[model samples]
Target: MTKPAPPGKAVREIVPGDSRWAELTHSDNHRFAIVPDRFVLPRKGHQVVAALQDAVDDRLEVSCRSGGHCGEDFIGAPRRNLVLDLCGLNRIAATDDGQRIRVEPGATVGEVQKALFRDWGTALPLGACSAVGMGGLVAGGGYGPLSRQLGLVADHLAAVEIAVVDEGRKVRAVTARADDDGELGELFWAHTGGGGGNFGIVTAYEFRSPAHLRSGGRILPKAAGGLNVQKIIYPWAMLDEATFATLVGRFFAWHEEHDRAGTPEASLFATFFLHHKSAQFLQLMVQSDADIDVGGAILAEFVAGLTEGTAVFGIPRGGLMTWLTGTRYMSQADCGDVMGARSASKSAYHRSAPTGDQLAVLYRHLTSDHPGQASYVMVNSYGGEINRRGSAATASPQRDSTAKSSWFTAWLDPAQDDLQIGWLRAAYEEFFAATGGVPVSGAATDGCYINYPDVDLKDARHNRSTATWHDLYYGANYERLRRAKRAWDPHDVFHHSLSIEL
Candidate 1:
């Protein structure tokens, strides 16, 4: 929670009883706050190497945290664990020609977005969590509001500087480029969507297309001067199963029909948030780059199409805001004080709309947020530029999905853990009941998004599908990611519950 040490300040190790230790120990996810023995705040990549070497020298387990938004307790080992908080390494440097921009692992989504927009008039399609670290987000194939138009943030990753340990336990910092055509190239490919904490600790990433995306100009996509964002809220108070189904089906149907890239509809994006009826309203947030959509006509047309035949109408909430301002607002409104509450998120990518049986399951649980608990099911419009890439081109292979959905719930009290977890688990499990309890890569559902890692996918009791957790997340790319893991982190210096196997 505390700001990282200022530049040139002495970076020190914080131990138990140090006032700073308590502040730095807890991650954004409050449920499983790590209890590492030592915490090191590294100001530079060399500092990261220094901290890592000490761990290797002492034969202690090492884990690195950039933004602490993993929402899982996977950073440090149970025994003697040395935790490296890379927040101090925050830096975003751009090339003189502006064709390349290198972002340090510690830079946040908000910081990166602001910097890119202000300096080069460019932007990355990062998720809504402003506080999320680029270290993890980009590495896991970052996607968000602009994703449908510009592709993923990972699609722009050209190079990565990672601090890895060799077989001799010697720490070395190496920059893996996409064109190396060797182990380094494979390493870079793995990082494209392999997720964090698997290969090694990432230091800095240069933003440019791994593949030759264009003839020339800036490597990243330019956001239309700002954004045209609008919020529409539909009252659940007036909704019956039929009405709800109409609204939901219409939203997905519209996306499926107009999912093609490089069109006016592709410029528009929407996130349909279905909150538990206890919240009283379902929200549909839409936005389009002003540069392309002009007066936001594209956005308006898309909204109208989603609600055309529905009996219910959605009332506009916030009129509109600038891209940066509206993005900040969306992040805050969607995830209010997440650091103060404990939350669980499960995700899936849908190749097509859900069946009637699945809609009934959604209506059943959504009607009851469980007395004191709060929950929401969010479906973000997908396809477009994201689907243009071939599946095997990168480590993240979920490129054919139309819409991505996230099932989430948060509670303040520890006592509600079982109630909240149980509710969300049932919601997700029953939704994919036809596939043996998991969103197997099939006709309706493509697979799960790796960024939204769920350890539950690994447990047979929860995931009763023949498809392993590997198939649900990585698909055919799992084995390739494993090869990179073995080559880079042979000793498994960095690991987590769902880290790729060697």
Candidate 2:
């Protein structure tokens, strides 16, 4: 129902005072603080890029928004001279006899899942959060529960449609693919995992679908009686350093053992939440890949091993639920509400399991003396089919690394922003120090996940190390990404705080 801007007026000057304007630029977590000068929804890629170039000529900063789920300032900021909203371009084109899909930058993961499932009984390796935008997620190195079996989302990318600023022209929409075998191909490679909005504005992506499908046009096999999701909640008062260490260590060990066996049927995810009142609670969500009984048993045994002779306990349960159903995939209304809030977060990737001492350090930071801060620690199991693929298979550079876990700490307190931000950074630094500072360079750490875009890693503010922007995201692939950036965005028109510095 939206209309195009009037001629001769820049997109920024045509701002609407309606509720939709606020909804378009807001985020779900309510953490980011951004308000673009203007919101422009282009009907197609060509129009979007043309407007972006105009903003650049006018010396306006641009922030690209698709689903607007980025946890940080990557989108929705007044500093953004122009807000390029791609939601209008949401479309899915089927190809490769229904084994391939070309998705617009604005499509939500949930929409894609439903569309693919309804049409071809196909699904992409998508994240649990359905509201996440496809553009940012894949560009930031997408991961999900299916990641252990299939691989990261970037691994499936075949090609991308990008709008880069040229020296003479403002910006041009060009196709970048593995087959190009030219400078553009390298740029396409960077787009695969270099993080979105760094090299250029990605308008569409070409992806390969899974080789097979389940009945009812489902991508994954239906969980017997739906998914058997077991949730265990343990009050914080009952957890001490030893208990926490035992639980974390045992969980890591179980994942490593199962992953080595090749089946890795049980999917386990744990979240330790530290509330404002010094209260602590642990919630664990377990899903059996295919066999509920076997998966449940594995989790049961693992929990028992960790809590043996201890007072920690959990309730075992299960039910019928599709992969998307259990994850609380978002509706359009939910997406609107989430983008309108404010919050901040930090994340890290661990190449190895933390030792008992390291775990204790993390506990102290989370339970520190902050008045109105809530911190959450999520440990997800990595490695399985994800590791079987070679590092160079796609733009994702973390394959060669031994990292078994990824962690995120989020706090919601506008008044205590400084305190919360400092706490997260210090805690992360302590964690890295305890582990010999896991290299941000691809050579040592395989670089960090792009989805959790951290400007600190690239800026001198927190990361004083000599790691280049490419080194932080692409590893040895950084050089290739740089070549692509140079070729496509030779004018450096599409850029932001943490964009790849060429």
Candidate 3:
């Protein structure tokens, strides 16, 4: 059974011409639309659940939006529907003992980091983009540079507070966890790696913080080394497919070897960014928390192997910026504000390394129709603790797949939407096909990364693979996610083109 929708008077008042309505309608990453009839930002979880129930009874489609970063039309859809904006519900509550932190779904990862840093020198292992909403990131199985040290963000989840729709236009507030409540735990597990806004509305998340260590009666010394950032840039035209493949493959191999050797260094993080243009270029960021010399030595060896007469140039170091506590929300806010202002991004994951021939094809495509903006393939290494956990232990289904890498192509020209999108899609499809469509099930490819959500894989118009799209993203857990969806949002009130289907 569930509680009925609250009376009309309880619903936040709104009129069609109001500024708030305009702001809400135009607020997501995909700015394009099917505007909603009304939008509400309930301050409390119970209030939101009640509103969702009422919207369901009215036969209105509901779209859950937080930070408006669900790429594509998930947040902007079906004009006469209702938009439940949870961004205003941001709140961070710590448990009495301080071992656990409870966060509202609307809270940004940056905010969480800030809160943790303020209370204690603690932080959650989340994506590098601070502006990403915690609700969506955790739900989609978050991974970042720190992932090598802490595993997926979902690994630390303790519980989730969600609003489930049930029994004839009613909603129930349920606390789902792994212990003391197995049914609810399953729901929590599903949400951990399952795509966002598909099952139910998650209002809050409870996570266990790492324990603090002390020496004798005093706290252990603060970490000694400063942050070091190394930048490596290579001209795009100079890099052919073979060079790119060698660069990516060698990096992955190095990361794997280091992980097996049990060498964990907080200062170690590597990323490769490609810019698509006449002067196409590759930029790599090597971040280390160790002594600059030691970090440089390790990085130099890796870079030397890749740059051996390959036209690789520019090895500069960006000095450490201030080390802030808690999630870097201010930084992410800048991204959201920019994305909100106007931006488009597309992403994909690889299950296997691109072969030499496939690389040639990719190089041709990237150089042929290069967009003026900084368009390039960004690769981050996943080693250390990331591989220590079994794939099934968390909702991130890609754990078992050999697709040890994820890549993205991002640029900032709103006017070039069609051209840019088409280029990305075509290149991605060609790459996937050449690699045996590793992202599709039954192909050597395991699944796609939920964080880099691509609607094409599921759209019959674009993807013709025999493998069902959902299986590639959720693996064997797709069925379980469906069951939970049936249990919580049976009517499929919360839906988008590529969201989990019941």
* lDDT of candidates 1 onward, in order: 0.83, 0.63, 0.64
- lDDT by residue for model 2 (245-280), tens: 777777766665655314645244333333322545
Better by TM-score, candidate 3 or 2: 3
Off by over 4 Å in 3: 1-15, 209-226, 237-246, 259-262, 265-267, 291-297, 309-311, 320-322, 325-346, 372-374, 401-415, 435-438, 441-444
Candidate with the greatest lDDT versus the true structure: 1
Each candidate structure's TM-score, on Cα atoms with residue i matched to residue i, is 0.94, 0.84, 0.85
Candidate 1, which ten residues in sequence have the lowest lDDT sum?
Answer: 209-218
lDDT of each residue in 1-502, candidate 3, tens digit only: 1122357434363446766665566654544654776677777887787788888778887777666666667777555567777887789877676546788878877777667666655556667776778878888878765565556677777788888877565788888875734567678888778878787898988886322322222211123234455566776666666776677666655664565312544236677665565545667766654443354566566667666666545556465544462113112244423454434454544444556666666677757756535445566766455556666776776663332444344455577677666776776677777433445644335657776666677676667676667766777888878877787777777787777777
| Clashing residue pairs for model 1 | none
How far out, in Å, is residue 120 in model 3? Answer: 1.5
lDDT of 1 by residue, 1-502 (tens): 2345547656767778777776777777678777777788888788888778978999988888898888667774454488888998899988566667989999998899889878876777888778889999988999988888878888888889999998898999999987788899999999989998888889999988533334337667765667788888988877889888878887788888888887778877889999898888899988887867888887888778766766778898564577778777666332653547888989999988898889999999898647423588999999999999999888889998889999988888889899989999998899889998888998899778878878899899889989998898899999899888899989987777888987
